[model samples]
Target: MAPETPAEPEPMPAPAVILVQPQLAENVGTTARAMHNCGLGDLRLVEPREDWLGDKAVAAASGADAVLRAARAYPTTAAAVADLHRVLATTARRRDMVKPLTTPRQAAQTLGGVIAAGHRAGVLFGPERAGLGNDDVALADAIIEVPLNPAYRSLNLAQAVLLVGYEWFQAHGGPFDMAPPASDSPPATQADLDNLHHHLFRELEDCGFLRSEEKRPGMKRNIRNIFQRAGLSVQEVRTLHGIVKELRHGRR
Candidate 1:
């Protein structure tokens, strides 16, 4: 019998790069160019102010038209992430939200696990004037907060995307094509976590745990951080939901 040839492994999937309300078409084009350089292809836009397919964008993309050509546009952040299983939003300034914070490298590693499981994942970038709104950040399972010089942490839209994409590319397989580390169980999806968060918050509200209007936001964020930092698994999240329900209504 003839020897069988070894089968090639499937290529690792890349996370989508989503620009939320991008202000400039040129920036969008450069962001596309950056994605191309990092071996990333998926590009999504939420309420882009300019025509990203126009000439300025193409010129800014340099030679990465394919990425721009295949890019998708969404009416809102919620709609953009409707099908994504995991989401990470980037922010330069410290937010009042209590989400798990990670660096570019760490976010890349997390995405590796998401990709390994064949789940859709994406990174959200906000507009130039201001970063992602609290509502947008609320939709994310975690936050990507790059550690930069304390004096100046500002990064243009393309630069931010490129930095994150570069880290992701390197982690996934850059020049070496290194395999990602295996995960025991899939982490809780954003939807699952969001449900947990809402359920817990509602119970807390009913119990008067979050009574102070002035302090409620900070307190809620702190509570969220406690769980977000835990990197809960799906089962863990379910257990928590049950615990919350049990606490609220006594034993069934």
Candidate 2:
């Protein structure tokens, strides 16, 4: 009998990262560097500022020339994400549209699942100064928001790409030094967390806990990030509300 053939290894899953109207060749190169660092190879450019393969970009890439060389360019955002089944737009600021919003971790998991199910996915990064326009964002099925200090939340193009890429790596069962303990309570949905944020913010605002209207946004965002990191459950959220109420009443 013939020897059994060796089984083929499972193909690696990666999402396409599309840079929409990128402003700097250096940023594009750095983005390529970041993508390669996280084992993501698909790079697409939508109307980049300079020749992506030029000297400056190559210099910035720091030996990720293969990624730069294999990159594809498109004329518009629509064309960029045309063939993708799942599309996510990365932005620091919240848009007014009603769309499924996800954290980087959540988005990565969703993207990984989609790819595993035999679908193509892509992430869109807007220009440096101005992020995705409503039109560009409208094309995305979901918005990926990185919890950050609201006062200074702007992330450089490559930095934003790196973060999402890192999450994607982790989502795909990438080896890591540590893993978070599973939550006892059901995972809190984004809407549930948002409601808690609103409830807490209203109370804080009423009691002047977050003073300095100018700093209020940043302060609230920082507080929210703290809770988000904790991965609070429904029960925990209610308990915190009770504690806040009791403390406020006692002070009064």
Candidate 3:
């Protein structure tokens, strides 16, 4: 008899990550890793500075090279997002671009509607150093920002990509009939978040997100990424439930 076939995953809509004027190889690699973690396969690079397929990127990606392998490069952000019907731009800083700001949750809700309508969507990330410029922001239908600490605001490009991708993934419910691994997956574990926190802070240390004075600058944003990627393991999510209860009580 033929070998037993493995179970197939559910079908889900695809989201294209459009990196406009991405400046570094390492960031591109990290972003690819982020996309892979969230089940997003489409990578569109608009004028990337380094080789996305170079060893620096693949190594940085860890095991997300498949995302890198399927990457597409373009000359402009508009061109990169041309085929997409819904577009979102990710930014931590204010853009004078005149776009409405939507939290990841709201964006996720909206994305679900967009997908239901059978239209493809794209999410935009700006350059590492300066971030998305006015023209770049103007290209998107909405502005997506993670709620970060007011005093200190900064996020890694890949982390930002992961957050939005996670929201979309959660809403999309993974592949069609199979539903990938989301929806049914339990909420995150405190232990998992703690572990994620450790890994994230280390990544932050590597990127200098946590400066000397403030150890956890914009930590909530980073935490959001961890929470987003972890997919809330069912048994592990009691921690989140307890934390919410404590917060509500504290407010009293």
Candidate 4:
């Protein structure tokens, strides 16, 4: 009789959790717990107001101190993400700038795809007082926002992370993709995206949709917003690029 082979486990992408200017150690610990619950272990702190490795954070982390022990700290958001090719920013507020806005589920889905391609991705949470600034969001490859009752949409730092992390876990059908299913890869690179943006602007100019390049800064933000929200694939971006190029060439 032939010996039976062991089944291969499905892969779960390990993601980094970035707390940008987190306000309290308690929240930091709680956030670590949330990440642990979702099978995520990496934590990065940026200019934290509270000592995450202190007693308060450890106490708040409850059974998740292990995750906290592994956490890393940075002086700036840029440094926190210096190594990641893909960045996802989480926020509760909407900006006037054009950028892609995705739900927690969508971000999770995108994360899955991005991870399949072997690129690093991190989820960014802004300060409790102001959330992520426009400049912060501008740096991210994607934006994730949770839906709550508009009347009272406020979510504590840990809760916001939990929601997103939970979706990410669900997307893989568990805390880890320790099964045989394969995932899709994320779209293009930042360079590829930048080129697409430039060509799209040129197409807009040809169509008279974009006027006075100085005023286009906001438009760039906005346009970036829409596509990021769409979470277009590499193939999709290529198609869009072709369309824009043809349009700019005055093709019928």
- Candidate 2: stretches off by over 4 Å: 1-8, 176-252
Q: Note the residue pairs that clash in candidate 2.
A: none
Tens-place lDDT per residue, model 3, 1-252, is 999999786576767888888888889999988888778899999999889999899999999999999999999888898888999888888876667899887888877778778899888888987889888888889999888787877887898888888877777755547545555556656676676555545655666656765646566566667677766675556565555445444566
Candidate with top TM-score is 2
**Model 3 segments more than 4 A misplaced:** 1-10, 175-252
Which stretches of model 1 miss by more than 4 angstroms?
1-8, 177-252
Q: Give the Cα-based TM-score of candidate 2 against the true structure.
A: 0.67
Q: State the TM-score for model 4.
A: 0.65
> Per-residue lDDT of 169-202 in model 1, one digit per residue for the tens?
8888645745555566678988888899999999
Best by lDDT: 1
Between 1 and 4, whose lDDT is larger?
A: 1
Count backbone clashes in candidate 4: 10
* Model 4, residue pairs in steric clash: 10-177, 10-178, 10-179, 98-221, 98-222, 98-225, 99-225, 100-225, 100-229, 113-186
lDDT of 4 by residue, 83-137 (tens): 9988999878787767788998888888888888888899999998899987778
Model 2: per-residue Cα lDDT over 41-88, one tens digit each: 999999998999999999999999789999999999999899999999
